[model samples]
Target: MRTCYTGEVNTQHLGQTVTLFGWVHRRRDHGGVIFIDLRDRAGLAQIVVNPENAEVFATAERIRNEFCLRVTGVVQARPEGTANSDLASGAVEIVCQELEILNASVTPPFQLDDDNLSETTRLTHRVLDLRRPQMQNNLMLRYRVAMEVRKYLDSMGFIDIETPMLTKSTPEGARDYLVPSRVNPGEFFALPQSPQLFKQMLMVAGFDRYYQITKCFRDEDLRADRQPEFTQIDCEMSFMDEFQIRDIFENMVRHVFSTVQKVELPQPFPVMSWTEAMQRFGSDKPDMRVKLEFTDVADLMREVSFKVFSGPANDPSCRVVALRVPAGGEMPRSEIDAYTKFVGIYGAKGLAYIKVNDVTNIPEGLQSPIVKNIDNDALRAVMERTGAQNGDLIFFGADKTQVVNDAIGALRIKIGHSEHGRKHGLVEAGWKPLWVVDFPMFEYDEETKRYYAAHHPFTSPKDGHEDFLETDPAKVQAKAYDMVLNGWEMGGGSVRIHRADVQSKVFSALNINAEEAREKFGFLLDALQYGAPPHGGIAFGLDRMITMMAGADSIRDVIAFPKTQRAQCLLTHAPSGVDEKQLKELHIRLRPQEAKPA
Candidate 1:
């Protein structure tokens, strides 16, 4: 319908007559001359309408923001001092000789130029919202990233294969979004949380390398980084171990950053074990940008007369940890008290601290009521262990290990941003990638009083840990590895248990009885029996990767039709009521409501 996009009319195209189609981004009037910024997905081009072309000028004068227009114009350089340095087509303007107002629009609910529009209002008029330059750039960046990923994988002999969206429900990580089966009557098919099973099955089917940019659905609570449905760059490979898979994906990620974002990532990403990451940073996915780390003070506090520290230290399930904040000694008492209350959300009992006012004189420098009970030597020992310096503040947590880790880990990131005069910036230039390996095969579910697979049941236990599968599930580490960028878990995969015997052993450890396993995953076990090769693969959350690459605050910013916090799509008004006839066909009935007297 058009010869060129509005954004393509640049200084290079000056004096060339071209046809362009787009919505009127903005219209301006200076005396008798009318100017309009015409916008399409490519970007914007300034269109000038002079009285010399009376008919075209009249059409341009009537056009409002969002008016769909088609124009034939000669691209010309903007007059001196009129060039827009901020735009790609800054040096040029389209002098319209002809104009066609294809469609007129009312003033939009919210201005496209307004940055402070509420998300709800913006979503309500999403068509207009998407016309914004930033939103356009984000979507364009997303497309480039996806394309780069596909190209990299395809070059490495990975087949672009697809998996079923409607499959049998199995407990993967999240709750499945089920579709009621009309043919089967009362049965349901679930949208995949991931292509975890089918991708593994492709390995069994002898497709050594497979990849899919697939949509996954989960009926779970929404977060800034999550949605009811999301896309994943799902890939799996056979005859490869954890290290081999990690290396391939890491390069692919680097390729994506370089090609799409024009940023060259580090050559080799630093690797850290699950145990080390957790112990030092209190989180498996540690934001290396923050310099803060948690130091164990359990041993030092165990012998202390103070019960607050001593009690948790004595308990095997509990821990005592501390965070040393640089130049944080001057933090107000109210601020410290507020932080204590903040940790309460993570079930932390309270936050304790020792503010070091000065390092030259150890006794006088330390400020804490607890320091009075402990001698100077003990206080000095605590300071030395935490690597505390003058003008540093040490915050402590004593509780169950989970509480301590959750509270302190989150606080580190929060404080890294909130604390002024702190060295708060990206951990390193470009990308800092890592493969976190050696995750536990199973974590003991205290509530269920049973072991649950840490990653998934199909993941193979590390070599020599096979014997511990039944003996001590907790001691068995999976050959799983996660690719982490900064702090986000970009993707994860593990070497699968190709042997049915080993897979069965894993199932047993996860408290999945033979009958239940057969019911849920019999196809997988049956497939494994027929020559399944040693394979592993990773699936990157496409939204998250794109969001991070674009430096967006949340994954929602990158998604076109994102859901609200409650997982409702405001644009589509989804999760709405169904017609009675439609419900009847599905053999469903709405529950009756109580009658109210009028």
Candidate 2:
């Protein structure tokens, strides 16, 4: 219906008659001269409908925001000082010779440029919301990223293969979203949490290489970075060790960034072990941009009179970490108390700190309640260990190892991104991608009194760590690597246990006996016995990747249709009721809610 996009018209096309089709982004009439900004996916172009052309002027007068139009005009240079330097077609304007309103629109619920609209309103009217330029650009960037991934993987001999959506319900990390089968009464097929098993099967089947842009479902608590259903760039390869797999995928990500974002990520991203990352930054996927780290003060505090520091310092399963916040001595008492309250969220009993007022004066200049309890030598040692300067604030987390790491680690990030940190130049700019490897094979659940796979059961133990699988599960490390960008885990992968015996040992370590293992992962175990090749792969969270690239605060912003935090789709109104007959056919019955006592 149109010869060119509205945004494509330029000064080079001056005097050229062109046809355009788009929705009216804005309409303005000044001194009887009508102007309409026509917007298409390409962008916007200004149309000038002079009153001298009465017929076209009359049509322009009727146009309003979002009115779909078909226009034929002569592109000409804009009148002096009337050009829009901000736009691609700003140098020229279209002199409307003919105008046709293909469709008219009622006033929209909210303006496209209104940034403060409620999320519910935006989601409910998603079609209109997506018409906004920022949303359009985000989706376009997503399309380009997907294309780049395909191009890179295709060149690397990876086959674009697909796995099943509905498979067996194998309970693991997160609860699965199940689908009831009407034909097989009482039987349910769960949506895949990932193509973890199927991809491994492909290696066993000798596919050699595989890749798929696929959707995965996990019925878990929602967060900014999470969704019930999300897309991943899934991949797998045969005969490659963990290092080889990391090299290939790392290059692919660099390729993606260079091609799509025009940004060159650092060559050979830094690699840190899981233990080092937790101890140093308190997070496996540490944001290297944050210029803060934990310093050990356990040895110095072991003999201190204050039990708050002495107890955890002497305990084997506990730690005493001192985090020095530069220029933090100036922080108010209220802010310090607020930080103490913040750490409590992570099971921290309390937050301890010493404001380094002056290094010259030991007990008198130092400001902290615990200062008097510790001897001058111990206090001086704590200061020396942390390199606490005259203007630094040394925050302490002395508790169970996990609690200390979680509390201090979270505090590090929060402080680094806070206004005070920015004022002190704590957060650095640009991309910081790294590989967080050497994750423990299993994590013991104190409540469940059982061990769960840190990555997954299929992941192979690190070299020479397999022997510890059944004996000391905590000592075993998986050959796992995660691609962390800034602070988000963009992707993760690990070498698989190709040998049947090795797989059985891992299952046994997790307390999954032969019978239970057979019931849950029989297919995977059965496939492993049939000569499965040594293989590994990574799955990039596509939503998370784009969220970082586009600088969107949440993955939901990049997604076309996203659910609320409660996981409800405002637009579709899903999770609705069904007829009793349909439920009977599926052999399902609704359960009434249990009433609470008055």
Candidate 3:
């Protein structure tokens, strides 16, 4: 129906007659002559319909924004001084020979160019929302990123493979979305949280290298970067160590950034151990773009009269650290109180600080309520340890280890991106990619009083650490590594437990008994009894990667149709109740709602 896209008409096609199909992006009646910007997926081109062509002009007069059209025109250079240098088709205009309104649209709910449109309204009118130029560009960028990943992985001899969506559910850290089976009454299939198990099975079945751009699900609470359903670049390999796996995937990411974004990431991205990451920055995924770090002040505070500092300092399970903010002595009292409130959200009892008004004068020059409680010598040690100079502010986090880390770590990032950090030029420019490795094999949940897999159950313990699996799981480290870009963990993987015995030992440490293991992962256990090669793999969050690439705030912006934080599809109104007959077939019964107490 069309010879070329609207945006494809340029100076090179001048004088050539072309048939373009698109929506009327904008229509302006300049006195008698009508002008329309015809837009397609490629972009937009201006179409001129003069009254001399009476029939086409009449059709153009009835055209409105978003009206689908077919324009047959002769391409010509746009008039001098009227050219739009911003557009690819800027230098040319299409002189309409024929204009056909394929479909008319009602006045759109909101203009596509309106930046302040609410998410709810945009989601409700998603078709129109996607018509916006930025949306088009984001989706196109997503496509190109996926293609680039596929091309790079294929070149490295990785086979593109498929994994089942509805499969047996094993705990992979989150609740699964279950599907009821009509054929088998009371039985359900869980959506794959990841292709974790299936990919490992592929390795045991002797597929040397495998990859999939596959969907993953997690029936957990949602956030800006999270979705009930998301995509991951799932990969697995046989006989490769952590180093080999990291090297291949790192290069792949670097290749993606270079080819897609035209920006070269560092040749060898920096590495930080998981322990170091948490201790220094209070997060597994540390944002290296921030210049702040934690400074230990426990020893100095041990003998101090202030019980708030002395109490946590004396306990091995607790930490007392200071974050030295350069030139932050001028921060107003209100701002410090606001930050104290922010830290309170993470379970911090309070935020303490000592403003270094003069490094030369100790107790006299320091400014803080707690300074008088702490001795001058101890204060000097605290300042010296943190390298606190004059006009700097030393913020302290004193609590149980986790709370201290969480509160101060978050404060670091917040301050780095805050008005003060920007005003003082603390946040660095450009990308900061790094590898966080040597993660603890398990984290002991105090409430549950049992160890949980730090990564996943299949992850292998570091060399000779298998003995500690049952004895001291806390001491064991995993052969796992995560690829982090800035502060986001782009991908994570580890060496798999190939032997059946080792796999059983890991399950035992997680407190899964033999009978339960047999029930939940019987197939995997049986497969492991046969010959299984040494293997490891990684799954990169495709949405998160594209989100960073496109500079979008949320993963939903990159997705065509995404659920809200409540996980509802506004466009389709999904998750509506099913008919009784359909529920009967699945042998499901709806429970009556209980009355709420007043």
Candidate 4:
């Protein structure tokens, strides 16, 4: 018999007989009648079995929760005053003429409808957990998002191309998860952190446009937004600069928002330079939902008697900045102390504040334990610059410029959510998309005392900046752009260096000696010499983008079988020990644990 999805049934099909197959969500008995809520991926349908059909009623009586069953039933309208408004087929019920149990499940560890189960427990039985409506919806949304991405890209003449997952490793980024080589005995193959190199090669190979929804693996510490293996909607195109690539991707994103959420984003997302973003908000990715902004107070602090402010202000590398929280003057001393401790996490020694009770009266209204030692003019200058009005509090961070930015930047986000109560609702409803361009080619790593590529080695320096490659690498800007939505970095890409000489120079500047560079990226360098094109591409974290669009806290919600925080598959218990024979076949020896002497 042909089967129909339970959720597809509606009142329009009343009096029509249909075969429905699903799991029994719940069973309710009322003397002569048994009602079963049959659930399939489509939705739920209430099935009624009358005692008059003694055989079917007997079969229904033995049915329990999660019992897989197929039932032939006639759809009929519910009795007067018995309709359920919560369900799509609420006004109708199915009368079962025949019942057959396809499979029976033992009682689940927890009820499928239970919302209180811990994530660990749910992950342990992911198949059962996925049966829940929420999980089903999440996966369905993910499918729709992926489809939308493919449709959008394809319409724009982008080709969906597949890249090799088993690719060689490159230096200068996160650690790679290596696969044991069976034939090579001891040598190993590394999983691609991204399809970065291959995609660039495709551009050089004259594939004008290429895209892939592929898996990438990175052996790194896990966070809410990270996994050992993840998917990216990788795209690359030839003869395109950073602006063109950014525009295409932004349009694609806007298309997804319009099609999926039915919400229209602004036409042009506001743009901010890297230096501007850092100076104003102390972060590259500043959440615009918050109105609070940082103001430089270094000049004002230069003459202040407070050494905490003067010490940092006097040093060239140090910075002193203040952030004003409006209507925050009433914040208790304990709360201020708490914020002080919070900034310490980012390397700030302490937090200083001036609570402005009244803006007009400077001396009496401005209250700060340390302000008494400062000149009134200096205090007024800070208040005026930060726009500190009545009932506002100005918090200051002083230290090395990096520390000040990190501490203040994180505090701004924390205060926006907790104190200001700004992070509310889904979608933030504002389509703030922008192309953050002209990024520095490299960042100086203090610990290593060397400069590393800010994006990657392949990124080409801006037109005029190429001359400064050896003499002043710091002044060079790359042809790179990051696509930002609201505050999140959706994706980033850059025009690559097509010439072999420039590529080698970038390697040299990154301190990758000739021998090491040849060893790690000889293939790429070789490929560059073979009639390469001026090409650039961008990659969007498909899971992250979808998760944000789906209004989920983490990308794991949208992924069907995501790994846990420790990068272990809970349902299948992956990353478990393998049999000795399997290891031997791979020509590997297990590392013995050290024995403790008694």
Worst 10 residues of 3 by lDDT: 589-598
- What is candidate 1's lDDT per residue for 281-379, written digit by digit as tens? 888888776777889988887778889988999999998988988878768888888888899989988888889987657678888877776666667
Task: Give the worst 10-residue stretch by lDDT in candidate 2.
Answer: 589-598
Give one clash count per candidate, in the order shown. 0, 0, 0, 0
TM-score of each prediction = 0.96, 0.97, 0.98, 0.94
Shift of residue 29 alpha carbon in model 3, Å: 1.5
Which has the greatest lDDT?
Answer: 3
The local distance difference test score of model 3 is 0.92
lDDT, candidate 3, at 125: 96
lDDT of 3 by residue, 1-598 (tens): 6887788778889999999999988999999989999999999999999999888888888889999998998999988899999999999999999888999999999999899999999899999999999999899999999999999999999999999998997888999999998888988899999998899889889898999999999999999999999999999999899999999999999999999999999989898999999888889999999999999889998999999999999999999999999999989989999999999999998999989998889898999999999998999898888898899998999999999999999999999999999889889988999999999999999998999988898899999999998798889999999999878989999999998778888999999999998898889878877799999999999999999999999999999999999999999987677777787799977775632222
State, as a TM-score between 0 and 1, how close model 4 is to the true structure. Answer: 0.94
lDDT of 4 by residue, 369-429 (tens): 9879788899888888988889888899999999999999988877776734443321233
The number of residue pairs in model 4 that clash at the backbone is 0
- In model 2, the Cα lDDT at residue 303 comes to 88
Better of 3 and 4 by TM-score: 3
The C-alpha stretches of model 3 lying farther than 4 A from their native spots are 594-598
